[model samples]
Target chain A: MYIIGELINGMYRNVREALAERDASAIKTLARRQVEAGADALDVNCGPLSKDPVQDMRWLVEAIQSEVAVPLCLDSTKQAVIEEGLKACRGKAIINSTTADTDKLDAYLALALKHRASLIALTVDKKGVPQDKERRLELAAFILERAAGAGLDAAELYLDPVLLPVNVAQNQLEDILRVIGDFKLLTTPAVKSVVGLSNISQGSKNRSIINRTFLVMAQAAGLEAAILDPLDQELMRSLITGALILNKAIYCDSYIEAYLKSKLKS
Target chain B: MAEELKMITTWSQAVCEMRLGAGRQEGGSRKVTLTVGGEETLPFLFKEGALPHTPLIAVEIFDVPQDDEPEALRRDLRGISKDPVTWAKAMVEDIGADLVCVKLAGIHPDGANTSAGQAVNLVTKILGAVDRPLIVLGCGEAGRDNEVLPLVSEATKGERLLFGDAVQENYKTLTAACIADGHNIIAESPIDVNIAKQLNILISDLGMPLDRIIINPTIGALGYGLEYAYSIMERARNAALSGDRMLAMPFICFVGQESWRAKEAKVPASESPAWGDQRERGIMWEVVTAMSCLQAGADILTMRHPQAIKIVKSEIQELMKKAQS
Candidate 1:
């Protein structure tokens, strides 16, 4: 699985204070730990606490990249903040993300093409998260059609079926799983799929158990990547176990050890 | 509504291209050099990536006459098996091999126990007899191999030859020799991708260039753990294409060595009447092994039988045609 470490975002208390105090070392520490935890990439977000998200995003990118070589996923609803973060990112940066809206997709596609970066496009539109598989597939089709019409390779595109809190969006969770599998048929060469794992268990009791269950089930439903806390030992173990069960990894008596070592391959 | 169906593709980062055998001005004296690696995707996955080069075949020739206990195994090379020079000559002039492999089996203490001088002489004779690029392999013993393989490597300096089976336990001497001699090295691992990659990482950490490395993931003949070997090579090759430099060198499989050793290939037809003629059965045995290795992304197949080599060459031609021009 392509794991993106989701710890550097300002939504967290430590990251929020780090952003306020302009702590580069704090950000670097998180970056190193996540990378050490086997994150293929790091997600950087200024969150709502930043007065100037563009400045904060740039600092996060440079601070993390200054110490580590892994790619950074620039997380922001604003395309300009993502673009500014891209300018600061030394290597390839993932633009996370855009919805099925045409204008939003056109702008993000242009930025992705100009920067030669991969994109995470959510299966959402002006109508918000779809409640059924057909609607989700339709929005996914729109993203693929527009991305392709814009000359982006499907491989370069990663489609996300928006994951909402299980406490509030229980009815739509099944549709999310179904859409993840059917999304492959929406385009040729199959657009990759990723999910923000924490979104599943937000505001729910037994969050770790809920999150792990959703991750494994989503993986079985064909999720190729995920935005999650690699520091969460149980979650990462479940992800590794799910991958083994899916035959993505060759079996060995010491497969967990092997996977841990090779997961560091970026 | 009717619509046209099209298969799109994903762009995989290409594997490194490794050049073997430096000619006169460059260093070696081979009439024709060979190159491998440089695949952008899994083997023959045309829609996903480009297969830049078809796998090359290097027929194996030993320095001293090997045991030919089974009369059926030596029937094809009865006269040629007696001398390294004659066998190598027939390998290039008659078999149409892409390259030649000289095994210093005689240098092993268990056998002819030939000295370094004798091993060097045999190597010189084969090099003189065949102008194709050469791959020189040592015996199975690491300690003994460490002793003589270096001398042969030094004697054949500037030939840009490919040296064999550098394992984790015995790579330092050979890697240094390869670097100093201006030749390539093949890092061999048991049928395990992790060990295969770890060996490459160790070799590359020696500060020698990675392009001079080839991977021998080890071979198991058909019906003899072939799938295990195939998966190891495939996974390692996939990792290489996926941008892991340590796992990315073109793979070299000892196809002929492993295939011809199988009981199915050595036993007589009368022993198993259900099986076909022993000669044809043995030939098919090697062909199937070589062909399977080709499918698993072997960049160099060191084969034995001339007829098996011919069939494999033709099959590779047909398989490669499926790639986009």
Candidate 2:
């Protein structure tokens, strides 16, 4: 599993305070910790607290990278903010998302190609998050079509089924999983899939269990990457075990340690 | 809608590439060295991955002469059976062995019980006689091996020999000696996959670089648990290609040692004429066993009979030839 650490996002109090205060050390610590905790990349988001999202995105990207040299997922709803983050990134970056909306996808695909970055395309548009599998697959197909039209490499695109909170959208969870698997069949070299993992437990009790369970199920459905908390030891353990069960990892007596070492080497 | 179907699968990692011997330029006297592993896909799926090295054959010669023997082997090795140096020479110069494995069998408590000094002296002579790289193995007795291997490891210090049969219960002394003397060690495990990986880890934990170690996932002769051994090897190779570094080392199968021990290989035509010519049956037994091992991802095969070795070598050449696309 490709783990993109979500702890660096401004939704967390520490991250929000650090971004507001321009404290490089605080942001650097989170970046270093996430990588050590087996994160393949870090997600940098300058949440609602930022007065100047673009500059803060650049500063956060620069600060975190100066401490640890891992790829950053430039997370923001706006294309311009994501563009700024991409500029400050020294390594390949992942654009946290674009919607199925044709205009937005065209822009994101062009921007991704321009910077040689990966873009996460969510199965959402003006119609809002799909309540069923067909709509999600339709939106996913639309994004793939636009990406192909723009000459984007399918490998550089990640399709997310727009995971919704389980408490409110309980009936749609199964459809989301089927769509995740369905997206693979629509292209030659299938586009990769990822999810904002924590969204599964939003406003729910027993959040960690729900998130861990959902992550494993999604992994079985071929989710290749996920935006998640690597520091959550239980969730990370489940991810490692899930990969092992899927034969994506080899079993050793200390497989968890082996997984972490292999992750670090790559 | 009818659509074209495609099978798109790929492995993210390849087995670690390892070199067995060193030359004068690299501080060893051998004229040739063998490199193995580096398969990015399953055995012989040439279209999917690069198989940079072909499977190699090593002829096994013991430190002591064999008096009590199988007629099939004694008939072939009549004169050379009494001396290790001649045996090593014939294996490399005549039999065309890619490498030679010197089994210090006499050092075992049940055998001649040869002293460590005697074993080291025999190894040094074999090293001098053959220009090919050597694989030095200790007697099966752990206590004697512990006492003997380090001395031989020191005496042949820079030869870059592949030494082994280091098991789960005892690996430290040899691992340390190999590290000090700059030789590679073989980590052996029973048929269990977890134990095999654990042994690799234990050996690596003692500061031995993983690539320098080979895995000896123990095998049985054909018709005697060969399928089980094949399954274990398949699982290990698959795991290695799936990004498991600890299990990613190349495999070494003892085709001759196990194959010759089978009852079918030993029983003569006089006793079981229905089994056909004894020598031909024995050679075929070894060949079939080696081929199965190679198909199941064996990188190095330690075999005995020259006829069997000749057949397997040609078959390997045929398999290594990828079709032009």
Candidate 3:
């Protein structure tokens, strides 16, 4: 289970506040806690709300990397932020995403290949998020092909079959899983599947529980990387257990040990 | 040389892996851990594949009966009938039930007219009194069940509680709660294999693991339509063993609900002398119904009568031993 700690994102009130004040201490604390809790990577997201989004992303990448040895996942909608974050990161980072859009795909793939960074590809194109599995899988394949065309290894691509909120469309749950499972079959052994873990449980009460359950189920369906809040003990436990059960993490005797050593720093 | 039998179906892949026990140290506070969905082959076929864990048995504890129960049950349960907490405790402590399934009959509109908070309190009392894993059930009233399950789930977080009758229309709240609370859910559909499969798919889509789900394909009493339920369960097991991941979870049955509701178990001795002793007859009715379902594919049986539960437990032990050998 490759946990991309989602704590550095500017979504939460605390994180947004920290970003606004440029509180490096707050940012470092969040990053260290996620690493101690079990995140393999810290996802640094500087949203458009920031005055200098690229410079803020660069500052976040540098601060988080300085505090923790774990890799960084450069998360941003803007290509400039991605470029800055990638440059600030010490080692190879995961490009938070690219869509099936031709221009964005070309730009994101070029940056990822140049930086020798992995990429998270959303299964959506110019129109919007696909409503069916076939379309999502088609979009994912296109992204994979485009990445390959850019001279990036297939293994570097992580497909995100975007999860639709259940409140909006109740029937979309299975459709997303079908897309992931079929994508697993369609892609080569080198390719990996990932998802924004919290999206499935968004808008529903008890988001943590739903998010944890979705993580386990998605892991069982062959999702290797998950963009998630790694500081959550329950979520970390579920991910570690799911990984062990699925034979993804063979070293740990039990989920407890797996989590303690891999996710928990202490 | 012995005759060579040709195999009709060839399964080369592993169907379902046995679920590890989920409880307190594993983030759940329950004393006994639940191990579900460890079928290497399908529901039952010891010769074909591995069935690691024995199907769990849960004793039913209702809030209060709508009407007078059968004389046999009335005799044993008369003392605790007034209070659900005492009744649930009696089922666990006295009856030696493996699991206590607390049915919130009070939540049903025609019953106590209890609010969701009352249901939550009752479930909390049951959880506090008993150390065993719980299966909190509703009166099968959709509106009431949907209302109560979420409250119950929130109140008993990390207990690994199993909740039920999550139908298509109102599973969101309950399923979401189960996910949040680290509990399990029962996806109930009519006794049709296809409907069962579809419901499982729907719940799984919500991100509930296959192991956390228990499929209730509805149930039938012995003289009513046991064969239909049995056939459907068998088919479901077949589909699971054949690598259909959707139908892989353990099967749960409303044994007591179905058997007690049937005419054979409810009617008095005076009305049916040919049925033998009413106590013996009613016990036999529940026992037979549960046994038949277990043989077909039921992995969890919620039973009523103590005598019937004893018989079913012994039979399960025998089957488990036979499978082990």
Indicate which candidate wins on lDDT. 2
- Taking the tens digit of each residue's C-alpha lDDT, what string does model 2 give over B197-302? 8888778778888789999999999999899999999988887887778888899999999999999988999999899998999999999999999999999999
**Could you give the DockQ of candidate 3?**
0.02
Model 3 / residue A140 / CA error / Å: 40
Candidate 2 Cα misplacement greater than 4 A, ranges: A13-29, A62-70, A131-134, A166-191, A203-206, B1-9, B321-325
Against the hidden reference, what TM-scores do the models get? 0.71, 0.90, 0.54
DockQ of predictions, in order shown: 0.10, 0.55, 0.02
Clashing pairs in 3: A37-A263, A38-A263, A209-B179, A209-B180, B18-B38, B24-B28
Please provide, for model 1 over B243-299, each residue's C-alpha lDDT reduced to its tens digit, 9 standing for 90 to 100: 456676788988888888899988887888888799988888989998898888889
Query: Which of candidates 1 and 3 is the stronger one according to TM-score?
Result: 1
Q: Put the candidates in lDDT order, highest first.
A: 2, 1, 3
Residue-wise C-alpha lDDT for candidate 3, range B1-325, written one tens digit per residue: 2233344345633434324225666775577665655676644566666777787679988776657577888886777866878877877777666888888887889877888887888888877787778888887788778777888888888777788878866688788888888888888878877667667667766888767888888989998889999998887776566545666667889899899888888888799888777888888999999989888877789998887888888888887886766
- What candidate 3 gets wrong by more than 4 Å, as runs, is A1-266, B1-22, B42-44
Docking class of predicted structure 1: incorrect
